[model samples]
Target chain A: MALMIAVSLPLLAALLCWIRPFRAVAWGITVACLTLSFAAAVFIASRILANGIAIGIPRWFEADGLSILVILLVSFVCTLAAIFAGGYMHHGSQQTARLWWFYCNYNLLAFALIVVPAFASPNLVWVGVELITLFAILLVGFENTPTALEAAWKYAILTLMGAPISLLGFFVLYWAYHMSGGGTLETWQGLYASASTMSPNLLKFSFLLVFVGFGAKVGLAPMHTWLPDAHSQAPTPICAVLSGIKTTVPLYAILRLLSVILASPEARIGNWMVVIGLFSVGIAAFLLLQVRDYKRMFAYSTVEHMGIILTAAGFATSGGEWGAVAQLMNHSITKSLCFYTAGAVLVVLGTRQIREVRGLFRLSPFAGGALLLCSLAIAGAPPFPIFLSEFSILSAGLRSGHNAAVIVLAILIVLAFIAIFLQVNRMLFGNPEPQSTPASVPGSVRTAILIAAAPVVVLGVYIPGPVHSLMTLAAQQLGGH
Target chain B: MASAQTQLIEGLNALDAGLILLTAFAMVATRQVQGVMRFFIVQSVFLAISAFLIGFNRGSIHLLALGVITIGAKAVAIPLVLKRTLPDDLYERREINQVINIPSSLLLALLLAIAAEFLVGPLVSASTDPVVHVNLPIGLAGILIGAYSLVARREAIPQLVGILAMENGAFFAGVAIAPDLPLIAELAIAIDVILIAVVIGVLTRDITRTVGTTEAATMSELKEEPYIWR
Candidate 1:
C-alpha cells in the first residue's frame, strides 16, 4: 500500500494540476507526496536491513536494497525540482494551461522514474522505463519552439527505435526462462538463478541487443546524438532532471541486468561493458572540448560521467561497485546543482551561449558564484563529492586488476576536466560582453540555487547515516564480493 | 507425400513466397510514388490471401479476421487516403530516380531474400512444419526490401508506402510463426498501424504546405547545423 501510494501520488497530483483552482494546491501536494515517499523509502531500507529480506509485491513490485537507493534518489531530486519549479514558474509569464501541462508531465515522469527500480518483473520494468521516454518527449518539447519540437521528435524516434530491439531481447530471456522450467517466474532473482542453464549463444545475443537498446537511453557514444539536443532544448529544471536522474535510472536498470549476467557461470558480460564504457568516455570527452553551448557542454559531461560509472561497474569488484554507486549519487547531486545554477544564469542573462555570457561575476553575484562553485564541483575539484567518487572509482578499477581500463578512465577524466575548465573559466573570468540592457534577477532564482546547492555540499562533507547504509546495501546487491 | 492435401499446402506456400519476392522486386523497381502505393496494395492482398490460407489450414477464426482486416485496411483504405492526398501534377510525373538502378536493386533484393531463407530455414525446419520455414525467410526479406524502399525513395508517399509494406511483412512473419498470439496484441498492432497512417497523412499535408513539394530530400534543411551555441 505504501509503495502504491508512493507511485500514485505524483500521478494524482498531476491530474489535479489541470484545474485552475488547484494549480497552486497541486504544487504543495507534489512536494508533500515526494517528502512522504522519501520517508517511506528510508523506512523501507531500514526495515530491509533489520529483517535481512526485501519487501515484495507478489510478481509485479519489490523493494530491495538497490531499489531503495534509487527510490530515495528519485524522491529526493524530484522534491527539489518541484520546489525549483514552483519559483521558476511563478515568475514566468507562461499561461496557466502551459504551466499546468508542464507540472502534470513533471509529476507523471516522477512517478514513472520512481517505479522503474521497484519492479521485480523485467518486462514490466522495461515497460516503465520506455514509458518514461514518451513522457520526456512531451516535456522536452513543452516550449513548442521548433528546435524543441525537433529535438523531441528525434528523441522519440531514436528511443522508440530501441524498443523493438529491446523487446526481442526480453523475448529471448522469456524463452530462456520457459526452457529452464521457470515459467511464470518473471522476477529478476528467478531469472538470474536459472541463467546458467540457458544457451550461451542466446545469452550473448540477448545481452548485446539489450545493451545497445538501453545504451541509446543511457546516452552512451554513437547513440548519444539525441542527448545534447534534448537536454539543451528542454527547460532548465527539466534539463536538471534529465541530466541528473533520468539518465541514471536507466543506467541502474542496465546495472541490474549486468548483475544477473555476471552471476551467470556461462557468460561474461563485463568485458563488453568496459569496451563500451571506454569508447563512450573517449567520444564524450572529445566532443566536450568543441561544445559551444554551456547546457550542451554539461550534457556531454553527463555522458562522460555515465561512462565513468559504467567503467567502474565493469570492473566487477566490491570496491568498484561501491565506488560506482557513490559516483552515481554524487553526479546526480553535483550535475543538478550545475543545471540549477545554469537556470539562474539563463534567467538573468537570457542566453545559453558561453561566448556571449562573459564575466558572470559582474552580472549577478549569487548566480555567478553558484555557477562557478557548481562547475568546480562537477569538474571534480577538491572538496567536492564527485572528486572523491571519481578518485575512488579509479582506485577501485586499478585494485580490481583492470589496469588498462583504469588508465583509459584516468586519461579521459583528465581530458574532460581540461575541456570543462576551459569553457567554465572563459565564462567566469573573461571580459563581459557589453549589453544594451541588463535582465533583472529574481530572488526566487537565488533561493532555488541555494536549495540545489545544499545537497552537493552536505554530501561532500558528510554522508548521512541512513543514505550511507543504503548505498552500502545497494552495492552488496550488485553481487560484488 | 503423394497426397493432394500435402500438394495443395506446398502450392500455397510456393505462391505466397513468390508473391513476397515479386512485391519486393516491384518496390525496388517502381519509379513513381503512385506505383509504389499500388504495389503495396498488391502486397497487402497477397498477405491477406496467405493469412486466409493459413486460417483454413489451421482452422483458426482469429487468423481469418486478421486476413479480412489486412485486406480492407491496407489494400483499400490506406491506398485511397494516399491517392486523395497526392497532388494531381505528382500523379502524372513518371520521373523518379532510384538510388541504385532498378536491375541492380532487383538483384540485390533477390540475394537478400535467398540469404534470409538460408539463414532462417534451418532454425524453423526442425521444430515446426517445413512449409512455415520457407515463409519465414520470404517474410523477413520483404521487410528488408521495404526498409530499402524507405531508404531509396525521395518522395514522401513512397516512404509511407514502404512503411506500410514493412508492416505487412511483419504481420506475415508473426502469423507464420505464432498465429495464436493474443487477439488483443494483434488488434493493438492493427490500431497502431492505423494511427501511424493518420500521422503520416498529417505530415504529408504539412510537408506539401511548407515546401510546396512532397519530396523528402528537400526536408534535409532541418538537419542539425553544427551547434553554434548563440
Candidate 2:
C-alpha cells in the first residue's frame, strides 16, 4: 500500500499541477507530493527490512531489497530536487506562466522513475524505462534554449534508438523463457529461477542486446556522448534528477536482467562487464580533466560513478554486490547535492564556466560552503559516504581475486579525484574576480542542500542496522552468493 | 485444414517481411521528408498485416488485439499526431541533407540488414517455428535499417519517423515470438509508442521555433573542447 502511494502520488501531483487554479501553487504541490512520496518510500523500505519483501500487489507491484533501495534513493533525490527547483526555477526568470508546466513534467518524471523499480514484469519494466526516457527528454529540453533543445534532441535520439534494440532483446528473452517451458506471467524472480534451464546462446544474445541498448541510457562509455550535454544543459533541478537517479533507473533494469543472466550455469560474462565498466571509468576520468563548464564537470562525474557501480556489479561477489548498491545510494545522494550546490552557484554568478569564477568561498558563503562540502563528498573524500562505498568496492574487487581490475579502478578513481579537485580548487580558493560581489543564496536552496548533506555526512560514519540488512538482502538478490 | 492455414500465413508473412524491408530501404533512400513519412506509414501497415496473419495462424486474441492496436497507433495515430503537432513547412521542405548520400546510405543500410541477419542467425537457426524463422531476422534488419536512417537523416520529422520505424521492426518480430504476451503489456507498449511520437513531434516543433532550423546536425554548441591548463 505504501509502494502504491509512493507511485501514485506523483501522478496525482502532475494532474493537480495541470489544473488552471493550481498553477500558482504547483511548486508547493510538487514538493509536498514528493515529500509524502519519500515518506511512503521510507515506510516501504522499513517494511522490506521487516518482511524481506514488500508486495503492493501480487505479481504486479513488488519491492524487494534491491528495488526498495532504488525507490528510496529516487524518492529522496526527487523530494530534495523539487525543493531546490522551487527556488532555483524562480531565480533569474520572469516566465512564471510556464512554471506550472515545469512542475507538472517534473512530477511525471518522478512518477516514471519510482514506478520502474516497483514493476514486477520485465515487459512492464521496459515500458516504465521508456516512459522515464520520454519524460526525461521533455525535462531536459524544458529551458527551450537552442543548446537545451539540441541536448534534448541528441538525448532523445541516442536513448530512444536503444529502445528498439532492447525491445528486440526483451522479445528474445520472452521467447527463451517460453522455450524453457516457463509460464505466461514473466517476472524477474521467475526468470532468475528458471535461468539455468534456458539456452545459453539466447540468454547471452538477449543480455548483450539489452546491455548495448541500455548502456546508452546508463551513460556508459562510447555511448556516453549525450550524458554531459543533457545533464549540463537541462535546468539544474532536472540535472540533479538526471544525474542522480535517472541514469540509475535504467541501470537498475540492466542490473536486474544481469542478475537473471548470472543465475544461469553456462553464462559467464562478468569479465567483459569489468572491462566495459573500467573503460567507462577511464574515459570519464580523462574527460574530467578538460571540462570547461563546472556543470558538465559534474555531469562527467555521474558517468564516472555509474562506471564504478557497473564495475562493482561486474565483480559478481557478495561483497561486490553490497559495495555496488552502497555506491549507488551514496552516488545518488552526493551527486544530487553536488548539482544543487552547482545550481545555487549558477543562480548567483550567472555562469557555468569553471574559469569564470574565482574565490567562490568569499562570494556567497552559503553557496560556496555547499560547493566545497559536496565537491569533497562527491570526489570520494573521507568522512563522506562516497568514499566508504568506493573503498568497499575496491576491497571487494580484491577479495574477488581481481587484482588487475582493482589496480586499474584504483588508478582511474585517483585520476578522477585529482581532476575534480583541480577544477574545484581553482573555483573555491583564489583571488576574487574584479567587480564580483557577494550574492544572497535563496532560503529554499540553502535548506535543500543542507537537508541533502545530512545523509552524505551521516552514512559515511554510521550504517544503521536496517539499512545494512537491506544492503545484504539486496546483495543476495544479485546472485552474488 | 490447419496445416494449410499455417502454410498460407507463413507465405503471407514472408511477403510482408519483404515489403517491410523494402519500406525501410525506401526510408533511407528517400530525399523528401514527406517521402520518408509515407514509407513509414507503408511499413507500419505491413507490420499490422504481418501481425494479423500470425494471429490468425495461432488464433491468439492477444496478437489480434496487438494487430489492431499497432495499426491504430502506428498507421493512424502517429501520423495524425505528427501532422497536428509539427508545422506544415517542416513536411513541405525537401533535401534532408543527410550525413551520407542516398546511394551510400542505401548501400550501408543493405549492409546493416545483412549484418542483422548474420547476427540473429544462431537464434533463428535453433527456432523450429516457421514464423520465427521469417520474422526474427527481418525484424532485426528493420531495427538496424531504421537506426541507420536515424543517423543519416538530419530533418526532425524523418528522425522521429526513424525511431517509430525501429519500434515497428521490434513488434514485427515480437508478434511472432511472444504472441501470448499479456494483453496489458501490449496495450501499454502501444500507448508508450504513441507517446514517443507525440512527445518527439512537439519537441521538434519547439526545436524549429527556437533553433530556426530542424536540422539536428547543425546544432554543435555543446561539445568537448580541448582545453589546456595554463
Candidate 3:
C-alpha cells in the first residue's frame, strides 16, 4: 500500500544511515530513499485528489484531504531538507559518524511527521507529535555546546509539560466517547461527524486543552519560550524542519479537531483561536524587533506565520480557509529557504549572532544574494505567495467583521517586515568583520536553496493545478463557512 | 449485583488512587531532592498496581502490559537515572530549592486538588460507578500538584520530577477514563518518557558542569534577556 511505503521507507533509510557499510554513499543513499518516500507521498496526494480519502488497514493509516496536503508539504520540504543536511553536515563535518547520526535522526523525524497525519487515532497522532519532539531534541543538542544543551533541555522539559496537558484532553475526549458512543472510541473523522451528539462540556474542555497543549508544539505565544532557543541552537537543516514542517503536526492536530468542535452550536474554539492568534502576532512583533540571531528571527517569524494561519482559521470563511492552507505551505517554503541561507551564513561565518558577522556579499555573493531574496519573500513582499496569501488573510478578517484583529494584524505585519529587513540589510551590505566567515560556500547548499526558492517564485503568481486542488480540499476539510 | 469480588476490586482501585494521591502530598512535603525521587518510585508503583487492577477487572491484556511497562520504566529505570544524575555533594545543596516555602507549597497542592475536584465534578457525576468517580479527581489532583511543583520549585531536577509526576498523574487518569485507548499509545508514551529522561539527564549533566549549578532560574535568561536591538 502507498501508506505502508510512505512511512516505512524513512525508517529503512534511517537504518541505512546508522549502519557503517553505507558510510561512503550514506548521504546519497539517504537522499535516494527520501526521494522515494517523496514519490510515495505524491502518489498518496494524487490519489486523495483523484479519488478520495484513503483509509489503510482501518485504524493504522488514513489520509484525508488535509492530511494529504500536510504529507505532501512535509515530504517535499523534508526531501529538500535532506539535501540541505548533506551540504550543511559536510561543511561542518568534523566527525563523519556524528553527521551520520544526524541523518538517522532526520529520517526518524521525517518518519514521525509522516506517521502523524496518517493515523486516525488521536492517541497515535499524539505519539507522533511526542516522537517528533523526542527526535528533534537530540538534534537540537547535536553540537553539545552549552547553548545547544540548554536549548535541548528547555525543549524536552517544555514538551514534557505541554504533552501531558494534551494527554488530559485526549483522556477527556476518550471518556466522553466512552459514555456517549456505545463504548467505541472515535477516530478523528468519526469525532468530527459525531460532534453534535457528544457531551458539550467535555468537548469544550478537550478543545481548550488540546489547543493549549498542541499550541505549545506549534510555538504559539505564552508557551513559545522554548522555540527560539531550540531553533537557533539546532543545526540549520533541522532548524528548517522545525520551523518549516515539524510545527505543522500540532497545528494539523488542532485543525483536524477544529471542524468537529465548530460543528457544535456552542463551540468556542474559534473565538479562543482568534485571541491566541492575535496575541501571538502582537507578541512576536515586539519580540522580532529584538532578535539578534538570524535563525532566531526566522524562528520568531514562524510564530507570526502560525498566528496568521490560526487567525485565518477563525475567519470561518472559505477565503480564510484557503488562505490559511496556502500560507502554511508558503511559510514552509519561504521559511525553510531562508533557513538554508542562514545555514550557509552560519557555516561560512561561524557565528549566529547577527551583529558579529557581516559582508556576506563580499564572502559568497551567491549565498548573500539568496539570503536577500529569501528575506524579501519571507517578509511578504510583492510577487511572493506570502504577500498574496496574507492579503487574502486580511480580507478574510475584514469580511468577518473582526476590525480590531485586522488592524492589529496589519500593523504587526508591517512592523515585522521593517524589523527583518533592517537587520538583514545591515548584515548583507556592511563591511566584513576582520577575520570574517569562510570565503566559499557549498554547491549542494546553493542547489537546495534554488530548488526551494523556485516554488516560492512560481506559487506567488501561479499555483500548479494539483497544489491548488490540494489546498481547496484542505480548506473544505476544515469546513470553513 | 454487589458481589464480594466486585467490592474487593473496587476497594483495591480506591487504594491505588489513594496511594497516588498520598505520593503527591509526600512530594510536596519533602524538600530533600532524594526524598522526592524516592516518592516518585512509590507513586509509580501505585500507578502500575492501579493499572493492573483495572486490567484484571476488565480482562484486558493491553492494560496489563501497560502496568508492567509503567513499573519497569517509571518506577525502576527513571529513578535510577535521576539518582545517577545528581552528584553526591549536591545532595544537601539541592535541598528543596523551591521559590515558595514548604507549607505554602503543600497548601497550594491542596488548593490545586480542590480545583481538580471541581473540574472533574461533571465527569465524575456522569460516571456509572463510585470507584470511577474517585479515580479521576485523584488523578487530576496528582497532575495539578505536579504542575504546581514544576513552577514553584526552583531547581531543574525537581521540575523534571514534577513533569514525571504530571505524566504519572495523567497516566493514572488515563487508566480510569481511557482504558480502551490502544496499547500502542501507552507504549509510545512509555518510550517517550524514558527517552526524555535520558536526554534531560545529558542536559542536566552539562548544565551542572558548565553553569556550576542546576537551578533553572540561573539559565532562564535565554528568553528574558534584555533587548539590545537599536
**Pick by lDDT: 2 or 3, better one:** 2
- What lDDT tens digits, residue by residue, belong to model 1 across residues A349-381? 778888887888886777779878998899888
Q: lDDT ranking from best to worst?
A: 2, 3, 1
**iRMS of each prediction:** 4.9, 1.5, 2.4
Q: In what order do the candidates fall by DockQ, top score first?
A: 2, 3, 1
Question: Please, what are the lDDT tens digits per residue for candidate 3 over residues A359-461?
Answer: 8788778888988889999999999999999999999888878888889899999998998988898789878877764746777888898999999899999
Q: How high a TM-score does candidate 1 get?
A: 0.81
Chain A alone, model 1, TM-score? 0.95
Q: Give, for candidate 2 chain A, the lowest lDDT window spanning 10 residues.
A: A88-97
Clashing residue pairs in candidate 3 are none
Query: Which segments of model 2 are wrong by more than 4 Å?
Result: B227-230
For model 1, residues B5-76, the per-residue Cα lDDT tens digits are 756966886788688779878888888766776788888888888888777777888788888888878877
Computed on alpha carbons, the lDDT of every model, listed in order, comes to 0.74, 0.90, 0.84
Per-candidate clashes come to 0, 0, 0
Clashing pairs in 1: none
A-chain TM-score per prediction?
Answer: 0.95, 0.98, 0.97
